[model samples]
Target: MVQFEAVLFDCDGVLVDSEPITNGVLRQMLGEAGWALSQAECERIFIGKAVRDERARIEQETGQPLTEAWMLAFYVRRDERLRAELKNVAGALEAVIAAHGHTAGRIACASGADKAKVVMQIQMAGMAPYFEDRIFSGHDLQRSKPAPDVYLVAAAHVGVPPARCLVIEDTATGAQAGLAAGATVWGYCPQGHGHAFQGLGVARVFEHMDALTAALNHKTSHGNLI
Candidate 1:
């Protein structure tokens, strides 16, 4: 059995099903600002990145400074759109509940989003109760995903060693963060990103949330090396 003490989850694509909505909004906003990226391109460039980092990249690429007021407005619009459109990823609640059952509540969220946004998304997706007070935001750290800071902090908060945590991630960047933190990372590749995740050295990739319990059970039964 893989000897994990905790399960850490990335919120956006993994649990909330908000990536398409958020990324679509981002694509529209950036297009209006003259970046004009397709939705797929926006996901490629921005998924699992911090908003500040994405904004900085936009500024650098366009040679146009995004004023603080403009950024604030952008966030407001994004949040409003998310509130209206976000839903839980298919089978996400059941998967989380199963994980919690196996780990005795040793589950937490380590997400790239800001804390407020994370909280709002989870609540909207009907997942707030499972992760209340156990959400760790990348915005809290100096460096976010792909840097390992947030994952390490999350493991610390949950009183688990990095090596004893299993992170559920969707994007390569988030998987990299878990790996860098010395955790076993599982990529949930429902969108057919399995090969991309394999390239990142994810321990396993599942294409559906319904497979989560079976995957964990298999690990527990086999004690497989991550």
Candidate 2:
């Protein structure tokens, strides 16, 4: 059995390779509404930001009403488009869930993605039942990633202490959040990472699920790899 009792995951870049597609959809949606956002602007002003923050920024930038109706419309459109293009991220669903059940560990998802959208994506990908009861969204916490709220909540919800929980994350913000919550944070740095996460006190860096499996196996010596 693995020594760790709980596993936590980030949703977007970690669970699904949907960041590029999500933003691409966003750019198209806003462009159709007559507001074309630059790439830098899309990344800088967005990326890991919660919907509330994004809506405020959008209204501020475009001098338009980023109202509830607009939010609903964008969400509906993204959901419609994303279900057809759901891309799995680097063995995320398979390896993570496999490790969880293989070792009797409780697996939870803590993500910067909003709650509704996270549910939609997970449901669409058929990964919901694996973690539905343990899902933790950024919108539920006062402070998002890099602040520790979401990860801490996840650890608590799954009945594990921060130290006994392992967080699998793919971004600096998410890794920092996990570490801040007092957990072992592993940075999953696959190819084409836009930002570097080398200096974030990550327990280890792995580019693939095989490396992650090896690291987890070495860390937990109680049993052989399953």
Candidate 3:
């Protein structure tokens, strides 16, 4: 059986059910900025991407650069809305607790969001206790997900060798980062992106949180290090 020393999770879609809410806010903010996009379009474009990358893409596509002041305003508005609307993914907190129990609390969140946003979301979801002082944000790295830098840094911070870390991600970009970091990656495809994740080198895919828990238990029980 494969051994794992730590569990690294992607924050937005995996732990907190904030993708839909965040993407909705993004759509509105971009719409007001003269980029009218449907929710699906926003998700397709921005999900799992770092803010800098998204900003560059938007500027390229719209032929207009967003001002720093406007970007700050968007962040303020998004954070305000997320504070009012964010919720934990169903069964996600339970899975985290269980994973923590199994792994002896070697858990860390690595996300392609700013640290402030990550901390805010985790605290708002009541999951700050699980990841307190164990969070790694894209802003901490020169390159974010789909580039491997953040995950590699996260593995180092957790004191786990990349090969001995198990990364749980909910998007292709995040899964790719895990793989590139040399970790065994499990894609949580609750919204039915199983095929996409499969193509991204995920070792496994689970559509439900319970399935993920069971998989972790089975792996550790079969001589895999927790």
Candidate 4:
């Protein structure tokens, strides 16, 4: 079994079901900007990514500049919808609790998202207490996911080396970040299909939060190592 000193969580799809809500707002805004796209196409292009990260594509498709003002407006609309529609991912609370115990409180939320949005969603899902001040956001770093900066910060903040941490992520981008940080990453594929994570080097691809909890509670009680 893998012995991990800490557990790092990704906030969006892993803990809170906010991806669809956020992506919906993004799709609508893109459509209004003259770039019509189906919800699946929008998600496929943007999920697990920061909006500004895809500025070129968005601007090219919309025939408009991906301006700061437009991003601000998107954030506003997205947050409004999130506030009204967000909910905890199924079994997320239980998984978090299990991780907390298994790691002896060495748990942190690290995401490639804005800190405000990540915080609000966690609080809204009633998971604020578990993370408290241990939240790290990529917006605060020079680089986001697929770069490893945020996860590196999170592992350090939790007083654990990256190699000794277990990162729970739901996207290949996130898995790349965790692996780049030198942590063991577990992909959370709620749909039970992990094709997206292929070749990402994630240690495991689990379809449910309960599976993660079970792994953390397995005989070694130190999280899945193999």
Candidate 5:
């Protein structure tokens, strides 16, 4: 059994399986600009980062400024192109909604996604109603993952103390954020990212989202510190 008053989730990997779609978006956009990005290159540079951070890396590599004007144009074009490919993280809707529905403490999602995109994805997945007013965008926080700002803000929104919360994260950065916030964290372990959290400080890690769900539910069901 786990002891916590609230649950917080990361959006991209934990709430939705949008990473590959995101990589595809980045790859296509970069490709059009004559920058040939292989799949490995996309994962290395873009995965697990806010778009702006990814853009910064792009700028660093390309040795040119990616202006606001350029970004605005790209967003406009990309949104239309990536619409049909949006998807949810496995057991995301089920896990968060189920826990929120049953537990006394509230459940919320903190995402690196921008607010507009957050609305679009969650609404498209029909997960908005579950979160309703409890959703938080990384833009709203002073810092993104690995800084604890987003998760801290979400915990505050849920009316719980950080120590009393459990965070679900898929990225090493997101898990770091939870740890920085002093929350108990469970990493949604992705294969091949072995030992990513071994020293970063997560309370637990699980390869299966179902396993994470079961653990959280087990803790809740047993009235053990939840």
Candidate 6:
């Protein structure tokens, strides 16, 4: 049995179902900017990534400079769609509660997205109370996911050693960040789409949030702790 002192969650696909909404808005905006990508193409490239992180690719595809003004516009449009359509991932609330109880509330959300967007999504999903003041955004760090900056910061802020943190992530980029930060990362692969996490160093791949809650409970029932 393994012990974890904290639980770190990646917000987008793990906690809330906001990716489709955000990606739809992104695809629409990119189309208006001269890159007419299908929804699948857009999601394939941008899911679990911050828009600015792919500035070069976006510029190359759109044949236009990636600018702050464009990003701001995207944020505005994305947030508008999110506010209207965001929903908590199935069993996410239960999973969060289980993790919180398992770790005595030493839980934090560490995401590669913008802080405002992350905060808004959590609030919209009614998870603000659990994650309030404990949300860490890579946008505020020197480096984002796949670099370990945000997860490291979150582990530090939660007063847990990175090695003793359990990170729940839905993307390879995020799982890599958690692994690089010295945490045991679990891949949350809802709908059986576990391909992205393949070859990634996640300790487990689960198809639903309920699986996470059950795992946490199993660990507790088995008295698995250092």
lDDT of 1 by residue, 99-154 (tens): 78777788899998888889898888877787778999988989898999988988
RMSD of 3: 3.5
* Per-residue lDDT over 1-226 for candidate 4, one digit per residue giving the tens place of the 0 to 100 score: 5457899999999999999999999999899999999998998888888998899998898889999899999999999899888989998998888888889999999998899999999899888888989998998889998899999999888899999999999999999999999999989888877888898888788776777877777743233223
TM-scores, one per candidate: 0.91, 0.84, 0.91, 0.94, 0.87, 0.94
lDDT of 2: 0.75
- Reference-based lDDT, residue 152, model 3: 88
Better of 3 and 4 by TM-score: 4
- Per-residue lDDT of candidate 2, residues 1-226 (tens digit): 3457787888887778888777877887777766798776776556666656666666766678778887788788788778878887756666666657744758888988888888777776668878867788888878987789999999888888999888888778788899999998777767745246666788766667665565455554221221
> Which ranges of candidate 1 are over 4 A from the true structure?
1-3, 217-226
Candidate 2 wrongly placed segments (more than 4 Å): 192-195, 217-226
- Evaluation by lDDT, superior candidate among 1 and 2: 1
- Would you give me the overall lDDT of model 1? 0.83
lDDT of 3 by residue, 56-110 (tens): 7788666788678877887898888888888888878877877787678888999
Clashes of each: 2, 0, 0, 1, 3, 0
Q: Ten consecutive residues with minimal summed lDDT in candidate 2?
A: 217-226
Clashing pairs in 2: none
Q: For residues 104-220, write the lDDT of model 6, one tens digit per residue.
A: 999999999999989988888888888879999999989998899999999999999999999999888889999999999989887677777778777888787777887777643
Candidate 6 residue 71 Cα shift, in angstroms, is 1.1
lDDT of each: 0.83, 0.75, 0.81, 0.89, 0.74, 0.88
| Candidate 6 ranges beyond 4 A from true positions | 219-226
Across residues 23-61, which tens digit of lDDT does each residue of candidate 5 receive?
777787777666788998887766666768776667766
When 2 and 5 are scored with lDDT, the better candidate is 2
User: Would you give me the overall lDDT of model 4?
Assistant: 0.89
